[model samples]
Target: MTVIGFLKKTVAVPVALAMTLGMAQADTIRIALAETPSDEMAAFFVALERAKANGLDYEWTAFSDEELAIQAVLSGQMDIGFGTPYAAMQKSKAPLRIIFQLSKLKFFPVTSKKYETLADLDGEPILLHSRGGGTDSIANVIEEKVGMKFGERSYVPGSSNRVVALVAGQAEATILDLSNTNKIMEQHPDMFNVLEMFEVEASDEALFANLDWIQANEEDVQIFVDALYTTWRDMNADPTIISKETNPDGPIGQLPPEILGSLDDFYTAAVKGGLYDPEGGGMKAAQADMEWYSEAGQLEGDPASLNIDDFWYMAPLEAAKAK
Candidate 1:
């Protein structure tokens, strides 16, 4: 079985190492990853390798979920992190600023065949990734749109785990990422159903950092963002580029050969599903985020009134595009 297939069977968290991309130094950016290494993050790893090639020094630690990753960045333990921490940013008034959108909110609500639509999920206990993570925000927006609240929310931390729960009959409903959603349906089409979800354009994941750190280390940040911008555009042009450019010794490449072989397939599906923005999701993403998060209850005030500059620092992305 493939590594992900094995993971689905055992519901295990994919292991991640504390990897440093270059010789450690006082200025090495410490990144807080929201989840362990998996196929979902292959493109990001390819970009990281490219940045390292261009003299961007960095290290990363994998947290169990987005909340922990956000806390690490907030507490000064990490220089950058991955998550949509709008609530934390607003409440803490920290100088947290998003630099690039990693992925859009392209999730699927998969449920047992018994539930036909979003309304049928009313009062149903649902499994999700984490308490305040992307899936949690999606659930909140779903409840608001459908005018019905979900019952007890069980946190599982990985989409594969949630898919396992759904397949094993441990969960009646849950949200999943594009690949996992496809995997389960293809494997057991008669067991579950993918509900028709409304379109979501806001970011599901993003690269954010404390403003002070970003200003203090503009060179490194620029290199990182530039590399990401190039990589994203290249992937959108030909998703197979991610699999081709991936460094064999890198985190993503160390996964089982089965997973490595499917990198092209994963990225192709991601791009087709609108999981990424070739432009790195600058102002358009920022505006969409304000509206989506407001509806998701993670941001207060009218989306129009919310100052996007308060959350997104667009200079790096703008500079990258100008090149």
Candidate 2:
């Protein structure tokens, strides 16, 4: 072959191989959300941008519920699943590991214009979030802590519906999250009473993947976890980052003006209320989560029997923490 042909053969072959390798190395993680975008979900989307900057690319699919999301992750259909199903995980023997705790259950108990405290709730028909959900969990804790039992419990899903019941004088009391809680307080500032409630020091959501998937993609998992750690830390420091990073045309921004207007206040309240845990991943969180779920009747058996390492893998988060 001529010198020109030889150069072409060597250069072109190596360049093509390099392109293939680059394509193979471009780590793109697929994540599944348990539900549609809410304030916290939108905050995570903001963190996706941060994750990209750290060499991890992502594609996401939102499941209608946590069960489906967990199934998807378990089947290897998604790289990560949100809203850790601790109870389901143990029951089904899913080989999943929690690498990050997203947020805690930030709920508020709202009532009619009359009730003042947990004592006032005694012997009165009360509305609960669901038969067995975060709201009921809180209600159970309240009953035990204050030694009072509500007269009748009604299952009403959706904070808005429960809020409507409270406003319409249909239901006496119920629990709500930050957004709906704020919405209620804003619209009819004096009509209802948002009773002071205790903060559940338990995990509401988590980042988890199949154990095999995590073991195989350790670097990508670390990048994803680190990005989230940074996002939570930064958001904790400055709640405004959410508003700044939120796409004005995105889902959160497109929410009704009332909600959009109160976004800043909602986040400010969340940050101050300890919504996000600074230690995104740890054994302490894992243990606390197990205890809470056990008492709530969601998880069974001894909390001590459950191994934190089996459920929570903290290496990625420890690496991400900017200490």
Q: How well does each candidate superpose onto the true structure, as a TM-score?
A: 0.92, 0.77
Candidate 1 per-residue lDDT over residues 233-260, each given as its tens digit? 9999999999899878767878899989
Which residue pairs collide, candidate 2? none
* Model 2 vs. true fold: TM: 0.77
- Highest-scoring model, lDDT: 1
The CA lDDT at 262 in model 2 is 60
Tens-place lDDT per residue, model 2, 50-100, is 666766756555555566667777766667888757765677666888889
The 0-to-1 C-alpha lDDT of every candidate, in the order given, reads 0.86, 0.71
